[model samples]
Target: MDFSFSDEQRMVQDSMRAFARAELLPKYTHWDRNDEFPREQWLKMGALGVLGLRVPVDQGGQEADCVTAGLVIEEIARGDFNCCYGILNSCFAGDILGKFASPAVKDTWLPAMASGETVLCVCLTEPHCGSDAAAIRTQAVRRGDSYVLNGEKSGVTLLMVGDAAIVFAKTDPAAGAKGVSAFLVPLDRPGITRHPYSDMGARGIVRGSLFLEDVEVPAGNLIGPENGGFSRVMQTFDYTRALIGLMCLGAAQATVEETVDYLKQRQAFGRPLSTNQGVSFPLAEWSAKMEMARWFCYRTLWLRDQGLPHTRESAMCKMQVPVIAADAVHDCLILHGHYGYTKDFPVEQRLRDVIGQEIADGTPHIMKIIVARDLFGRDFV
Candidate 1:
């Protein structure tokens, strides 16, 4: 596989980096503090074609390959972590709808989604079932030309602002995994309710809970076949989880930056902090991990472009990147000492945000399990 990025790719990366610095970083902390979603930035992302990077051009997308998507997202994440979460769902939503939604549904939604006029979130995690999505209890009952969706979805990102969601529910409770189905439901429906779920990090990501009380969507809103949606959701994950890995690399890059800034001025034993091997070793280890993790992400993306099976690579990158970032955040905190614990400093916020990522796409333990399953043929315990 060609690991080198083309000139066009480099230009895209550089342009996104510049845009992120100018547009995202300056306002990032303010949004975090105020718990605000920057709709303006999301629009800017749409104008730049950043929101539809990995989506198909036939569906009003830029037709970006997976690596290009990773490049765009990594730059945004490096400058503002929440930008990663927002851009991620922005693009992934359109991708899912384009791939699975019916022609009429796509024709209705894809144009608005591509233009950033509409926002979207995925509703897979029920209050009871999270990563184990097959355990979803949300049920959809057929009611002559409509499906009545009834249940509550939790840990929902972008719900407060999203216009549509790919809601997961059981079409037949007895069928287990085969029973899971997805519906493209609008947030404005009368029976649907969205409320904020306050949390420790990624404040602008706007976490919320979605409640469905006999919410009705047209039969045409069904995405893929009834009782066969788990495959679609996992297919979406196969494309997206790598992007989350790159997001972790961005947070690690920021933590390394804080380390560099503090080391020049911080004193220990009448010398600079960098002079101490105790402080420097962890940072050095983190540096190695980040560098390798970056390349691993790119390679996995390239594999995705080649239509290769990259599930194991995505799981490995997802598992390792956050662990490395967490370690770097741990040291960067001690480097700041008391200042780190205070809200006045950004490191404290960075710490919480990176830790929150461990559970964002898939848990670290789950990633390891995925890798093992991929390697050992599902027979080995």
Candidate 2:
């Protein structure tokens, strides 16, 4: 198997890395502190083809493949770990609409999203059910030409600033997993309310809780088939989980890179801290793990573009990158000694932010369960 990036892919990685370092790094803390979502950054990245990478050119996108999309994500992450919020906002909702919605729906949403005029959030996780998606309690009842959605979806990224949400709800609660359905619901409606989520990290992310109390959506808003939404919801993870891996992969890379810089600059016993094997060896180990995790993520994307089943691979990547990232960040933090534990140094924030990735896409335990199910049997889960 050839493991080289094409000219276009190499250019994508290099260009996005440059852009992210320039735009995202300087303001990472400011956005986190001020609760600011960069609308202008969205427009800028859209101009750079960072948004809607997979949509057709006629629909105002770059018309790229899944591999190109994954490369863009990985590069964005390499610069600013929190940039994954933008990636998921653009790709997850957009890809789902492109694959499952009608032409009219495509004609309406894709153009604006591609141009960065609108941003979308996915509302699927509820307070009661997270990784166990089939156990959701939000119900949407069909009325005459309309569906009244009444449920709360928690942990929705960027819901506080988004224009719309691609939400999942139970249309036939009795049918269990087959009962779920997807809908594109506008956030400006009467019954929709957004509340900010107070969390330890992801200060750069605009996490929010969505309450849809009798939110009436047009029947035309239904995104896929009536009762077949569960599969679509599951499929949405195919785009996001690996990107989450890339996000943590970026954080892991940042941890090592920053620590290496600190070791060179900081003198210990009248010598550079990195000169000692005690410091150098562990950093080397973290670097090794990070490099392996990075390739695992990209290779999974390659397989995905090849139309292979990547569920098991994604789970493993997601599982491994966080452990690597969390360990690397914390280990590097310890290398910094006192400064690492302080917020002023930013390593602490990197540590805090990387911790969230372990639970976000799927819990570490959930990923392990997926791996077990794949290796042993489906009944293992």
Candidate 3:
């Protein structure tokens, strides 16, 4: 099997890497330092088509393949890990809307979203549920031409600055997972209120909780069909899980490069820190692990592009990559000595930023359960 990227893919990868280094790396720390959102950078990314990788070409997007999208996010993450969130959310929103939303909904939001003029967030996790998404208590009741929604969705990334949310709620509470339905609800809706969180990492992404108190949206905003939201979201998660792996890997890879540079220039006992096996060995190990994880992620994305079953592979990516990335960044931090602990260097912030991903998407525990279920049969697991 051919493992090489096509010429077009390589060109896109190089261009994104250059963009990340020149534009995003310089100001990566500014947003986290001031607890500010990277709105301008996000807009720039939109202008660069980074936010539109999953959108259709007719909708002003590249409509790139899944593997290509993965490549773009990985390169972007190297420069600014937090900015990668915009691409991640956009890809998720683009795919969901492109395939399911009504013509009006698609025409209005997709182009604007591709242009970076608007942001959309997925609201699935609730104050009471996360991996147990089916247990979400958010309710959306039909009201003639609209659905009146009421529920609390916690851990919504980009919520504070988002224009709207793809809110998943139960239309028929008795049906459990089957009862869940997805809606594209504008954040400005009368009963919608937002509360931003003061997260330790990825603060620039501004994750928060969305509270819908009798909020209303036109019935046409329904994504897919009623009672079909759960499976749709699960399928989406399979795609994003692979992206998450690449995203975290980019951060870890960047940290490794930075550590290598520092170690070579810094001296210990009249020699560079890189001369020591102790210092170099950890970096070596991490590099190898991250390389393996990166290929696994790309293959998972490849499987997706081929329309093959990769739910188990995606779960493995989610379960293993972030932990590997976090550990690699942590070691990179330690390798930098006491300086790594300070905010003066990007390593500390990278550590903080990378750690949050360990919890985001799906926690390792939840991911492991998915893998286990697949391997041992659903009944045994």
Candidate 4:
């Protein structure tokens, strides 16, 4: 019944909100225009302890709960949507490595990643397969003391600047999903080539493809069991699906607030535009939708904190919230008229940024399948 955040949660939220407005918002467009990575801001986020919320305290991270991590990402997205990608990558890498990686691997990467001295990316999607993740063609074969990996991973976020990658490859192709394994491969290793994309939005993060040819790593780099990586990554996605919802909602909410101010001062037909229900009702409607979606996402993250069944809830958030956020931003752009189309206002950028998320974690079609399978049971579905 209690819906309010705790004192500690409030403190974290207030600090991140202020940091977003002061440090991140001012330079948000600068990085996009220049096609540069926000390394300085990434370090600042590390110093603030936001980058390691899911990493263990013993491993140089805050090791905060899932709900607190959700708050941090949402607030940051309000200032810079692309920067939220860093938080997402860190949390995924932190949780997966802290729990399952060997001491040597964890010792080398976890602390540096938490300190923002290095970055890690998850390599699951391939050029040939995205939604059907199990059908990936990446292959890893065991040698006497090392595993040789050869595959092309596409649609990776932050790959251009990633120091290492949690690469997933098929160790037993006949076993389907159970045959997959994960490895911590340093990007500087030989036989690795990277190619960056010219994305329409969020160009600051620099999504790219990782081509691995005969890349070798020690056996100790294997995460979890020999064939347990598929389930481990899917579990991590459940946590991130809710986070994605909040991230998009943050950007949309900021646009809503900005449009409200613009509407009130804008004169139309010798009267303020805010006076007309036609001009104001869409904003009001989208506001209510986003508010409802925001609370749902929070509840989903809370369920994760409590270790409850939330796969269905997480899929629902992924399925609906981003679409709602994208629609709201598109409508807000229309409201801004000619100015919204131009880079003069952030609305246009927000629209392009928000749309990428609609396809990132899981498309609506795939998410629908997850929810349907849950509702009717696997056999029935």
Candidate 5:
């Protein structure tokens, strides 16, 4: 496959980089310190067509390919890792709505989401089930023209400010994964409770628990065929995992650049620290890894665009990129000395932020399971 980015893709990447440098990087620290979501910047991204990367143009999105979406996310993450969630959620949730929701629902919600007037969060993980999403116990029972939802979703991103959520719950308890279904629930509805987490990183975007106690969702909000959402939701991960990898790489790339610059300027025994093999070698290694990972991520996205099976590639990208990013950021922090350990510097925050990616989407262990299942066949594994 050709690896070169097209002219349009190059323009999209350049535009995102410029926006990040001028708008996001300057204020990311303030948002992190105050635990504030930069809603204004999110709106700016929407206005710039960044939030609507995957949504069809007729639905107020750019109708861009998956690789373009990944490029936009990588650039944004470079400026503020937390803000990349805006893109992730928009694309993930929007894709579902665009594909399965009724025309009315799509017209009503997708445009708002595309314009940043509404934020969408996804609810899949329950209090007891995360990696084993098929084991989720959240129940949605049909009652008249609505489904009354009950149970809690943990580690839900953007819950505090989300206008709506694409919630997955068990519609038929006896069928295991086949029993699952998806619904678009409005967050303002009664019987919904949100409890935000005080997190180690990505503080600007709230991660929280969502409790739906007899929450009434209109029957019209059901997404996809009833009892058939598990496969659909799982398929979206092929796209999202690759984007997550790119996002982590963006953060890692930033830290590596900062460390390299510091090393070049930091004096040690009458010469630059960068000249020393001890200081430079590790940075060089990490830089190479990040570059390789970036290509891997884009390749996964390219596979999706070609309508090919990318489950293995996506799993590999998710498994490797975040770990590499976290290590790179950690080393960058150490290379900066005590100043990097303090909240005064961004490296410490980058380390914390990228570390969370190891758990997001799917853990390394889960990714390994996927890769193994593919390689050895499910029964043999």
Candidate 6:
């Protein structure tokens, strides 16, 4: 199989890289320091066709394939890891809305989201559930023409800034995953409240808790078949996990590149640090591992585009990439000596940011379970 990127893919990567360098790199530190979301930059990215990559062209998106979407995400993360979370949410949520939402809901939200006029967040994890999505406790009870939602969603990305959310809740409390449903709830509703988290990294994209108390949502906002919504939404993660891997890899790649340059120039023991076998060998090893992980991400995306079964591959990407990236960033930090420990260099921040990815989307343990279950029968695994 040919492993090369097409000209169009190369163009997408280059364009996104240029945009990140011009728009994100300069302000990344400021955003990190102030814990400020770059709302303006998000808007600019929307104008650049970055926000709606997964949505079809008719729906105000670029109609890019999964591989191209991953490239855009990776490039953006290279400049500011926090910003990629917004991109991920926009692409993931937009794709879901485009496919499952009613035409009116699509017409209303897709354009606004594509243009960055609105922010969208996904509410899945509840206070009691993290990786085990089937155990979510949030409830959406039907009431004539609407659904009354009452529960708390924790660790919701972009909740503070989001205009709306795609929430998953249990419609049939007695049933397990099959009884779950999804809804597109507008955050302006009276019964919704948000509390932000002061996280160690990715501060620009605030992680928060969303509380719903008798939040009434119109029946028209239901995303898909009531009980079937759980399975449908879970499928989206097969695509998103690879993108998340790429995002983390991008940040780590940037850190590695910076360290390589630093080692070439910094003298130690009467020679450049790169001349030492200790420094060079480990960096070489990490470089190799990172390259392998990068290709794994792209290949998984390509398989998704080909309409192949990629759940196991996607799980592998998500499971391994973040850990690899964390190691790369950590090694790069140690190689930088005292300078890396300070906030003066971006390595420290990259380290914190990439570490969080190990837990984001899905943890390594969860991913391993997925891969194992796929390889062995569920009963055996």
lDDT (10s digit) by residue, model 2, range 204-279:
5779999999999889889989988989877768657777877777766766888899999999899999899999
Model 4 TM: 0.99
Give the Å shift of residue 293 in candidate 2. 1.0
Candidate 3 lDDT, 1-381, residue by residue in tens: 999999999999999999999999999999999999898998899999999999988788889999999999999999999999988888988899999999888888888988888998999999888988899999999999999999899999999999988999999999999899999998998998999999999989999998889998999999999989989989989989999999999999999999999999999999999999999999999999999999999999999999999999999999999999999999999988899999889999998998898888889999999999988989998
Q: Would you estimate the TM-scores of all the predictions?
A: 0.95, 0.96, 0.99, 0.99, 0.99, 0.98
Better of 1 and 4 by TM-score: 4
**Tens-digit lDDT string for candidate 5 (202-288):** 898898999999999889999998998899898998789999999999988988898998889989899998998999999989988
Q: Over the stretch 1-381, how does candidate 1's per-residue lDDT look in tens digits?
A: 456899999999999989988998778678888988878888887788887775568777887888888888888877788877766775676667777789888877776776777888888898877878789899999999999999999998888888989899999999988999989998999999888978888888788999999999999999988987888778768657778878867766876886788887888789997887877787887788788888988888888899998889888888887777777777788877788888776777777878887888789888889999987888893
Looking at model 6, the pairs that clash are none
| Model 6 C-alpha lDDT per residue in residues 1-381, reported as the tens digit of each score | 899889999999999999898898888888889988889888998898888887767779887899999999999988888888877887787778888899888888888888888999999998888999999899999999999999999998888889999999999988999999999999999999999999998888888999999999899899988987788877889889999999998998888889999999999889999999999998899889989999999999999999998999999999999999999899999999999999999999998888888998889999999999988989998
Clashing pairs in 1: none
How does residue 378 of candidate 6 score in lDDT? 99
Q: Candidate 2: where are CA atoms >4 Å away?
A: none
Residue 64 of model 6 has an lDDT of 87
Report the C-alpha displacement of residue 379, candidate 1, in angstroms: 3.0
lDDT of each: 0.83, 0.82, 0.93, 0.93, 0.91, 0.90
Give per-residue lDDT, candidate 1, residue 345: 68
Residue 271 lDDT in candidate 2: 96
In model 1, which regions exceed 4 Å deviation?
267-271
Per-residue error for 302 in candidate 3, Å, reads: 0.2
